[model samples]
Target: MSAGDISLVAGTAGAEVVAVAYRSTTHGEVHATVNGGHFALWFPGDELRDGATEGVQLEATFRDGSTATAVLTLT
Candidate 1:
């Protein structure tokens, strides 16, 4: 799937998103735009391992000092 297909939302409203990391690699802030309590992250197509079945961890950091993680399994 394209990066545009995925969207992220912060757990705490009004919190500013700091960063989003995938597979231990931190993407630049330019790839993630924070809008209110939600944000969208764009990842490089190659980073997703297109045809592989794997569970990738997405770590999100907020300016409020809170962090959240989610695992996305791609087939």
Candidate 2:
């Protein structure tokens, strides 16, 4: 496994970003916030490689109670 990063634009004309989450059964969970623009999340490759050989899920929640999901895989 290797360290990874993901960037996303998580807001709209009316709805805005409420929270962002990175979840992994092996790496645990991380939560963050964005100030209406693009946001990026990074995970340590060394630490993640110890156990994370599976897919990790990323979620973005909006102020409108809407959510988006993305999956990333580490080989």
Candidate 3:
């Protein structure tokens, strides 16, 4: 597992990031807020990893029934 922080641009209001998962591993819910069309969340330590240096998938769910998917390197 890997522990770290993740950041994204909300791009709009009323968007609350509810969850984040990497691969098949689910990360704990970190309170997310959008200020100036941006917000950040944390994956902490040892909850998001598969020993991959790149191409790790992260899926984020919003409170408005919206979802966003992304990929990045896990350290």
lDDT tens digits by residue: candidate 2, 1-75: 344543322333223767777774445776655655555555544444422455556687888888988654544
In model 2, the Cα lDDT at residue 47 comes to 41
Q: Write the per-residue lDDT of candidate 1 for residues 38-65, one digit (tens) a residue.
A: 6555554355554246665667777877
Task: Count backbone clashes in candidate 2.
Answer: 1
lDDT of residue 40 for candidate 3: 43
Model 2, runs deviating above 4 Å: 1-15, 47-56, 72-75
| Clashing pairs in model 2, backbone N/Cα/C closer than 3 A | 3-45
User: How high is each candidate's TM-score?
Assistant: 0.42, 0.47, 0.39
Q: Supply every candidate's count of residue pairs whose N, Cα or C atoms clash at under 3 angstroms.
A: 0, 1, 0
In angstroms, give how far residue 62 of model 1 lies from its true place: 3.3
**Candidate 1 C-alpha error for residue 4, in Å:** 16
Mark the regions of model 1 whose C-alpha exceeds 4 Å error after superposition: 1-19, 23-31, 43-45, 50-52
Candidates by lDDT, descending order: 2, 1, 3
lDDT of 1: 0.53
